[model samples]
Target: MSKGEETKTRILQQAAELFNQQGYAGASISDIMRVTGLQKGGIYNHFQSKDELAIQAFDYAIASISKHYRIAIRSKRHAIERLQALIAVFGSFAENPPIAGGCPLLNTAVESDDAHPALRERSQQAMNSWLNLIRRVIQTGIEKAEVQNNINPDEVATIIVATLEGAMMMSQLYNDTVYMQRAVNHLNHYIENNLKINGTS
Candidate 1:
């Protein structure tokens, strides 16, 4: 990458963590300067405005999260196993998030809702992508007869995402991983018993 391009990327990476850790409104231009080591003029040279930078950084953060998930499920063959892997991914988020702040989806959703239109839309898009991915896995499982044919992919995906997000919030709030751990354990068991392996049922 060219020098300017490399600098722009570095800004995005640093700003992503800053925004995730501090809400969009909570993070100021001075904060960005502090994080990126770039002056106001240097920052504006790349991003048109703070709003523009915020949007791009959010996209960057979500992309980072998606990349880690792709790595987590890359080797799994079974759909149930893939879903279980997702649970483990969320568990890891509590300990070591793709970004420093925690789950970008949860953080952005909570902070942006009814507040920032641009960032809110970005969070919704990222969530839709996540939900669709989960739904596809469940649908594929049904097709492969690894899970019951009657299983509702939409419903299952919602349950999985909601459970993990809620658990992560509680964990982060209490400054404890046990809540996330409980969520992971419950979801894993839910897959084992409720989803039931093809022949196990």
Candidate 2:
């Protein structure tokens, strides 16, 4: 990468963490500068405004998490295994999050609801992407006859994603991992008993 590209990436990386820990409104330009060791002019040369930088930073964070998911679920041939991999990686957030604070998508969704329309839209898109990933896995399972035909992919996907996100939020708030573990465990049971074909492994 060129010097400019490298600097921009550093700024985005620092900005992403700062924004995740302190919402877009709470994280000021000075804070970003502090984290990145960049001056105001240097940051502005790369980003038009804080809002623009925020949108890019949010995308950067999402991309990191998405890349991890892609790699984690890549080799799983079975539908249940793919879904389980999804759960496992998400649960891993408690111990090894891609970002500093927690789930960037969840945090931005709540903080940017009425604060920043662009960020909120980005959050919505990230959620849709996640939902689609889950649905695709479930759909593939049905096609392979590994999952029950009667199962609704959309409903099941929503439940799994929602449950996991909720578990993460609660775990963060309570400063405990039990909530996430319980959610993950219950999700495992649900996938095995409800989604998987009775005789299939």
Candidate 3:
């Protein structure tokens, strides 16, 4: 990459970490400059304003998570294994978080709900992407005869998304990973028993 490209990437990287740690409202452009050792002019040369930076940072965060998921789920051939891969991803939050802050999707959704429309839209897009992925997985399971034909992909997708996000919030609130694990475990059982064809109860 060119020197300018490198500097711009550095700024985005630092900004994403700061936004994740301090939140969009809590973290300032000055704070980002301080962390990146860039002058105000340097930042402005790349990003027009903090709002723009926050959106870019949010994108960067989502990209990071997507990259992780792509790599993590690549080897799994079975839809059930792919679904289990998601649980493993969440399970890792207890031990190793991919980002400094909690889940960016959750953080941005909650923080931007009232304050920033752009950020809120971005969060909504991220969630829809997640739900779409789950829905596709369920559809695949149905095609493979692993999941029942009558299973509602969208409904299951919503339940999984809601349950996982709620679990993450509760886990963060209590500073306990066990809450996430329990939620995921129950989700796994639900998928296995209810959705799977001839699944054992």
TM-score of each: 0.97, 0.98, 0.93
Model 1 Cα lDDT, one tens digit per residue, 16-62: 99999998999999999999999999999999999999999999999
lDDT of 1 at 89: 89
Please report the TM-score between candidate 1 and the true structure. Answer: 0.97
Candidate RMSDs in order: 1.3, 0.7, 1.9
lDDT of 3 by residue, 3-82 (tens): 99899888888888889878999997789989999999999999999999899989988888887777767998777778
Tell me the spans in candidate 1 whose CA falls farther than 4 Å from its real position: 198-201
Residue pairs with clashing backbones, model 2: none
Model 1, residue 40: displacement in angstroms?
Answer: 0.7
Q: Tell me, by TM-score, which candidate is best.
A: 2
* Per-residue lDDT of model 2, residues 158-197, tens digit only: 8998999999999899989899999999999999989999
Which residue pairs collide in model 1, if any? none
Alpha carbon deviation, residue 85, candidate 1 (Å)? 0.8
User: Whole-model Cα lDDT per candidate?
Assistant: 0.91, 0.94, 0.85
Query: What is the TM-score (0 to 1) of candidate 2?
Result: 0.98
Candidate ranking (lDDT, best to worst): 2, 1, 3
